[model samples]
Target: MKGWRAQPGRLAAIALLVALALFAIIKTDDVMRANALVAEEEAAMDGAAILASSLSSELDKFSLLPLALAEDPQVKALVAGDRDAARALDRRLETLASQSDAAAIYVMDAQGLTLAASNHALPTSFVNSNYAFRSYFREAMDKGSSTQFALGTVSRKPGLYIAARVGPSNAPSGVVAVKVEFDRTEENWRRATRGVYVTDREGVVLLTSEEAWRFHLTGSAPAAPRDPAEDLRQFGIAELPRLELPLAGASGEIVQVPLVEAQQAIGPAGWDIHLIVDPGPRVAAALATGRLVLVSIAVVVFAVIFALFAANRRRRAHEEAVVAQRTRTLREQLSQANRLATLGQISAGVNHEIGQPVSAIRVFAESGSKLVAAGETGQAAQNFSEIVSLADRIGAITSELRRFGRRQPGEKRIVAIGEIIDGALLLLRDRIHSHGRDIDLPEEDLRRVTVEAEHVRLEQVLVNLLQNALDATDFGGRIAIEIALLPDAVHLHVVDEGHGIPAASRDTLFHPFATSKDDGLGLGLVIAREIMRDLSGDLVFDANRQHTTFTMIIPRHR
Candidate 1:
């Protein structure tokens, strides 16, 4: 009887040990699975955010097109019933649309009649189409500008239409619109993730990687009910099909449906991008890792704890040393990279500075050859002399580039303002004649004023400014150079009859890589400003002027 009682106590102790082991295994698995799920959710959310940003960037690329087109003189004339401008405007719009990779660009009259379109040559062209009922057109006419996503009435394709009102807001003449499609964006999303979709404020899917989910509603009901007629016009469907995504269970238990979802807003648009992720593999791996950890803890509890602790301390120290070495190496690499970047900028500057002289040289050479063939010996000799001067200019440019690379300052001396102006104009004479643009030089006495500066650097700055003016001015446009003598400084103003710089671009006018020209490197003004500052002078823009103006201020030579 005593032996039986003892056996019952032993059995109870064994049962208690088994229960504790089971509890530990279950607890470890739960914790590990939960952590893994959280990590997966976070990663999915980050991915969704990145995708949303990309979509926003894509949309932004074409957002300014309509506004720019709205300001076009040809578009304005066409809107004013100038039928002769339609042919030229159509070709220009077609070229612009092709270059910008936009789906379509079109101009509409006050009646919302498409007057000209980029696809006017095609059979399905938007020309002659009336979009008076379209929200994009109506909204733009009322609000000055608007963006609307809808299905194309004729093409039956979904795209975002960005529209801007032409002329004054109070009496708008017409509207300019650019359509941007998300075909490439959707393709990229399809390759990057599964079950990616974008929903507007009404929970209707506007864009999706899965074609079947497009135009589907997100929840049981729309956020705001839309008019049936508007819904039909926008999406070609009055009743949108609900999206049926497999969602995870609410109990925090790993269920058979292992999908996790994340949502991110795209720009100011009340559109949300959703990314769906499958966490089945991650959860399984976490469970396996937990089981292994439990086994390891049980085996190493008493025997290897102290040894492991000491080894861990040694390993940490070694890792710290390694990290310090890596940091030093990284710092050295970064220094080297900075040096390379500086070298690249210098090279780009040299390349840009040399182009004008080289072009002038070619023009002189060609003229000389033609003159020689025509038996005009004196004129040919003059052309050859100009070529030699251009070659000398090239040599000076190279020398300056080398000195700049070495960080050596150029020697400054008193130079007449007329000398700088004459040198720059001489180099660009052929270009000026070819473009039929005129330059109004300062008065003879005003040109006599002297400034203290490096001759080559000052001439380079002037040349850069003149070249920009030449580019900005239209054929037969006039550019005027005016010199004003201050008590301690001389101001050289370069004014062009071209369109003034937009207010939005004024902040970055002198910043590197900020340019309005399509083929410009955006380094000329930056280099010119730096050169002026180095010479104890300054460069500034006059924003108050009706025309474009750049002023260079130099210390007056005593």
Candidate 2:
């Protein structure tokens, strides 16, 4: 009756509907991701259990070897004042240690004293003191064969101790101990695990792989340069007692049981084998794929629903067009509102982005003007040249921003991509230093890529990428830009040793008004993408390597 009155309130209703739909879609996505993460953690825990079981089993074999040698009649006769037999036994032990992963092997007296060791060059005066109270010695006394772990005296390293008893009759007479370094233990465990670390009951790390060490040492104070001995002293075993670590997190209390609980005698007390499995990459990949599928379905459904709603709400084709126009206007108003809300932040970013080059130009102009007014011809010439240089820099900045923001079609010209990338680095040099970052350009060999694109716009894209990289990487971590020339296209890649963009956020990383950062307007990557597209190029995320890389590719003959 009211001539089908247009209600502006209906626009609010439509926005509310879109919001609810997006909330549902996002909620479902989060649930799926959570479930996937849980599953991955469970799998990793199960794998660790299997690895522990396998390591215990392998230790049994090593334990048996010492027992066999101790019980051998020839070995007993040799140790019983038979010099020739002792020499032969020492040779055998030496050969075993040299051939296998063992570091040292030796026979001890019935008193748990060191006797003939594996090598003749080894000091026999090194009596195995403080060992009678050792669990391995007790196990050899009772169980005939046992394995334990202790810090090495000579090497100042941690080693696994496998010991067994040798006797003339059935009664045990002496003990034999085989010392295997912790590296060997790690190597064995690495067969089924990513990283393995052996620590004392106090959580003091004993042995770990080089890769694992890198992560641990990252936050430590920088160590002074040293020789091998000093290096070992810093990282190796010490006489200082291990400090206890209190368990505070969800993992609960730390347990210091024997390697075997009841009677298996796998190893000694105060020793733990910790396995670290990096499930990040696998989980990220799986979650990304699943998210893609679910988002695709949701997007398709939402589009169909929106079309149906439009048709139902507006009967005529012209009416539908008017409704679409209204929607566009509403979107624009919303965007303007948001921008207004962030006026301060926008102002700050604009200043940060433009302040330096403008200051440089001002300085140059003032210097030149003062010199010319004084009629100092020589100084004026120098000042003028400087002013020209500064003006050129200001022009470059403007050109870059223009090309980034505008939708002008590209003019293709054969150019070296590396030169453009270096130019970008030059622009950001001050910023990089201010932020405590080091940006390393790729070697000439890696950067020589011939491509066709709008030169100034391409340089703008490169500057954007390198600056982004510097922000992402830590002070000591590397940021590398590489250029590769392919048969059909040229690729420019920016790699950073930083926490990568989350898999969940990758899709919207280049989208306008989409960002995880609190201070960002979300226009940088969007502008970068548009420029690349105008140049008939593409920007994409590449996760093939350990470092995260953003790759831009433009056709060679465009």
Maximum-lDDT candidate: 1
- For model 1, residues 410-472, the per-residue Cα lDDT tens digits are 578888999888866655565677779889999999999988887756766777788788878
lDDT of 2 at 218: 19
Off by over 4 Å in 2: 1-10, 122-135, 168-172, 185-274, 277-287, 298-558
Candidate 1 wrong stretches, greater than 4 Å: 1-18, 220-224, 245-258, 298-558
**Error of model 2, residue 185, in angstroms:** 4.3
The C-alpha RMSD in Å for every predicted model, in order, reads: 27.1, 21.9
What shift in Å separates residue 335 of candidate 2 from its native position after superposition?
A: 54
TM-score each candidate.
Answer: 0.50, 0.41
- lDDT of candidates 1 onward, in order: 0.83, 0.62
Give the distance in Å from residue 253's predicted Cα in candidate 1 to where it truly belongs.
Answer: 18
In candidate 2 the C-alpha lDDT for residue 431 amounts to 67
lDDT of prediction 1: 0.83
